[model samples]
Target: MAGFLLILSLFIAPLGLSQEKVETIVNKLPERPWAVVEFVRGKVLFNGAKVLKGEKLRVDGSLEVSKRSFVKVKINGWDNTIVLGPRSAMELKLSAQKTGDISPAKYSLVKGACRWVRKKIEGQVEKGLGAVHTPNAAMGVRGTDFYLKVNPLLGETEIIVFDGEVEFTNELEVTDKKSLTSGQWGGVGGRYGQKIGEILNLSKAVLDKFGKKLNI
Candidate 1:
């Protein structure tokens, strides 16, 4: 009975965390947070401070997660969410147009892994403006769900597109772009990137992991 109770407590602890569903807006440059940390675990840091649940993320700031930690945030003014994986460092830049609707999200993943999710815009499809920059390549995403990981030792960027498509391009060549559809994944490094093959289908275990991390 004691062992069972301990296991149940471990699973139930995270359920008690506050998951805020509200949106945050930034009217101008250097304004309030463009997003807020919806959930956090272990040692997550935002702009040098220890990140707390519900902490606002500044557009000009950066985030770092220690080993065994993760942080999820909801982007304001845009339909997207970002999950920073353990041992990762990321910087966020969000620009807003005069109409108050922000431009597509931009992120720089300096180290480690992260997941990106973009909700469908009002009428846009097939094309997206969100971009993520890694050491080896850049990714242009439409309304899609994707995962990216930067190998610190190999200097390679791994990408997996769960929904929609992502345009992967080598940072050295702006014209080089490869589109990866749902269930497709590949790697980018040394000035080139290629799609390996489609995954056919994602297992329930994989879906559950992403769903829990991003809260899609």
Candidate 2:
């Protein structure tokens, strides 16, 4: 009986962890398009510590694991955009288009999750300011319609082929590094091993959903 109980305990522990779902928007948010920062507690901090449009809420500091915090910020000038996941972080920078340059438009996603819809990105040296260099892989962000997902906890990164081609680099390979065409995906094993996962065909519905220019 003792040996049987030990085996069951191991299985039950993982199930308990998998069952816990991360909490969703806990605080009352202000009106849309305004800078809204939320805490783990049911309270929110509105426009510079002042309650402009949202309900008056005390700044709750419960932003650990039991709770989560996120901020929504937007700028008017730059035509660039970024999207993030839950409990994720990222930094954004944009370069204005020059007169005669091939791609004066450049965007850099330093960390976390971001979706970039580029106008014209065609060179490696033409990356906005600094490039996104993860622990194991490097991407020459040629202008394309795509997004990057890097898990902060797992230190794993996945580059999904949305549209256009992206040049990928790591450590081991037979020929030169490969570019991910549309509807394909690749994984980085953190040890210079490029594991090719899958290639998918675009059905009519899948094409309609991702092919059109939809708002983020």
Candidate 3:
């Protein structure tokens, strides 16, 4: 009887330790932030508190931008940046294991517009991964520059791909998928099921203006 109890205790101890080990890894992930605020203009709030220029943001945290305000965040360990427009709120999910790894982040856009700019790394393609989730659509990032806007009052979501490509899918059903390449713009969440529209050439002035705002 005593021998059997000892054997059982040994087995149970290892199992308990392994379970705690797994939990430790998962808990540490929530503490990691995928991006940090590099520049902030006007009024910006992080987790309902005022955000400093160097504050790190984690997942599930609320980011709010007031009128005439904008925030620029630099993605950790990657040559990419994201800018949030005025009168916008979003829930962030940014975490990564290390630099150059597949770090998938998503911003749940509750309202207003945001832009992502991926600087080209010489001889390297696909350095980072991210997505923008609206009320009705999920926009996938594919190593490119793009903009997403969501109007909660009007129930509209718009996307513009300035460089590379972006794939959009119906958030609820996940069945409808549409791809848009450079110089393309489209909208989702309306009375009709809209798809990607014709490509419109983006002028240099427009690109230059966005570039200047991206204080990366």
Off by over 4 Å in 3: 1-33, 95-103, 125-128, 191-216
Order by TM-score, highest first: 3, 1, 2
| Tens digits of lDDT, candidate 3, 110-190 | 999888777777677663366778888887755788888888887778777778887777776687777888776677666
Better of 1 and 3 by TM-score: 3
Residue 147 accuracy (lDDT) in model 1 = 86
Candidate lDDT (C-alpha), each: 0.70, 0.42, 0.73
Candidate 2: stretches off by over 4 Å: 1-79, 91-112, 121-130, 171-176, 190-215
Model 1 residue 174 distance off true place after TM-score fit, in angstroms: 1.8
User: Per-residue alpha-carbon lDDT of model 1 for 1-216, expressed as tens digits?
Assistant: 356445655665576632121111111323232788888989988778898988776557788999988899887656678898889999877653322233555688998988898888776644344578887678885688888888867667877777877877767666666777777666766332342222335566665565454343
Q: For residues 1-216, could you state the per-residue lDDT of candidate 2 as single tens digits?
A: 356445555666665632222111111222112112221232223323432222322222211111143333322222333333344444322233333322232223334554444445344443432244444455565555555656545555666657666666553342435577776556564432344334345566665564442224
Instruction: Decide which is better by TM-score, 2 or 3.
Output: 3
Best of the two (1, 2) by lDDT:
1
Q: Estimate each model's TM-score.
A: 0.69, 0.44, 0.72
What global local distance difference test value does model 2 have? 0.42
